[model samples]
Target chain A: MVRLLRFLVEPLVLPRWWQDALLLLPRLVCGYLLAFEFGAVKFGLPWSPPDHSLGLFEVAFWFPGDVASYGGLFAVLPGFFAWMGAFSEAVGGLLLALGLGTRVSAFLIICTMLVAIFMQQIQQGMWNTLPAAGFLWAALPGLVLGSGRFGLDYILAKPRRHEHV
Target chain B: MNTSRLSLWLSLGFLLPACVQPAHNKTVVYLLDVRGIPNVQQVGLRGRDNPLSWDQDLPLTPVGNDSSLYRTVVTTRTGYLVTEVKFTVNGEFELQQADNRRIAFGAPGDTVVYRARFNVAGSLKP
Candidate 1:
């Protein structure tokens, strides 16, 4: 179990520290905007707009309906998917920002972004897909590299004294 | 995942039930026809109600595949016989009209549908 946990938490260390620092920039910016701005508007969080009157963890009233409009499978269980999508953005973004469970968070973010781009925004125009596309691109590296060396995953995955022998 | 991350996910899972709120006994559906209005401008509502404040604007979502139609639903525990409201374009109230639009609600457990055209008075459907 410990070995499996280490494999999951371990990050890919880059040759240079500057590479990790460079990667952190987009993760921080996208994660902050996702958690505080985009996700907060639709999902219930502590920092949601006062006028919205959203309780903690509550999905905004209109969000489920909006998700249903995506049609097919999304329409079948809109509420569940809406809650999951919002959770990925609001909570997954926070995890991404903290550099904890970076691969899992990135995977969730990537799925939500794909739906936002193709199902929702594609019909409107390419320009409409840019925001989701940007987030998708930002998460792609995290999915592969697991937050690099600048994240909590690296620290948590470091070999302990007992493991050294 | 590490123990800390796994615990965090579990805690969030426990909070999932809170995402669904109790159903409101009263519902008001506001539909706006924006065919006459510019597409670039965002349409919203400012009303005197629990969900709406006279000072803040509540943005309306666009109806499916229709750029000229927008809708919003406000649900409350108590019903109001009549509520004064005004539509806004880009956060600016429709001051060109002489009076604010009025919405009348039905009895408890009833859904009231209010439809009106932007910037037009007396355009509400019966």
Candidate 2:
């Protein structure tokens, strides 16, 4: 048991940036898959309810009037938020794929995921809750490490603009 | 720049659906402005057995009447639900329930049921 624990905690012998790359690739994939799922469930060729989610109508009616009202903003905002959310997830997913401005895109997507979880999937319990939290966790690592391997950030780190042969 | 333009078009696409009315006749208009708790469930009133396929699963607002109360409506040919809202939630937001004797429109002096849980604010104009 102690040996397994030590192995798990042991410092990676690989360069720091390589470690970042290993961590980043999986996160990028998860983010992309999650975004695809969001679009499929909400706006694909045939829209379907999320695997364990309540319908939009049901979620809207669960809150107190004043909060739900949004003082007349409700008429347009929900749709707007939905659009923004889908777009963010879709685009953020792609950007993360290439490791371009990953931190910023992930942050925006993290906020979007939070709104989705809170407004639509709160009752969905841990299954829904963990994915939303995962987006945040994945994002924090990007913010800490910046983009990795062939990313715009890495390219820009070159001392001169025309460094290529 | 190309990506941004694509995003802008997608934004417009998402909005287009909300602006137009869906073809499915009698619109189940949601009256209350609550988030998270839906107050309207549009069940089809077709055939004698199990008209409501709970699979459609429109969330209904639970009213705060002392006793259990429910309201169901059949859709007109136009597909508009001649909606009958029921109010039957318990606790601080309790509301008086309307008589459940008949499934038709209530006449003057007859009990009128509100079709969801409600707080003691915002009087309806009609």
TM-score of chain B of each: 0.71, 0.23
Q: Which segments of candidate 1 are over 4 A away from where they belong?
A: B1-18, B21-126
What digit string (tens of lDDT, one per residue) describes model 2 on residues B20-102?
21222232222332323344332222121122232233334323443233334333221111223332232112233432111
Candidate 1 chain B, poorest ten consecutive residues by summed lDDT: B16-25
lDDT of 2 at A147: 63
True contact recovery of candidate 1? 0.14
List model 1 lDDT by residue over A78-155, tens digit each.
777788899899888988988899989989999999999999999999999999999999988888888888889988
Steric collisions counted per model: 0, 22
lDDT against the true structure, per candidate, is 0.81, 0.44
Interface RMSD to the true structure, each candidate: 5.5, 9.0
Which RMSD values do the candidates have, in order? Answer: 10.5, 16.0
What would the per-residue lDDT of candidate 1 be over residues B3-119, giving only the tens digit for each residue? Answer: 999988666555553575333456889888878666436788888766788888899988977568789998865322556789888887885547778766667678889888888
Lowest-sum lDDT 10-residue window in model 2 chain B: B42-51
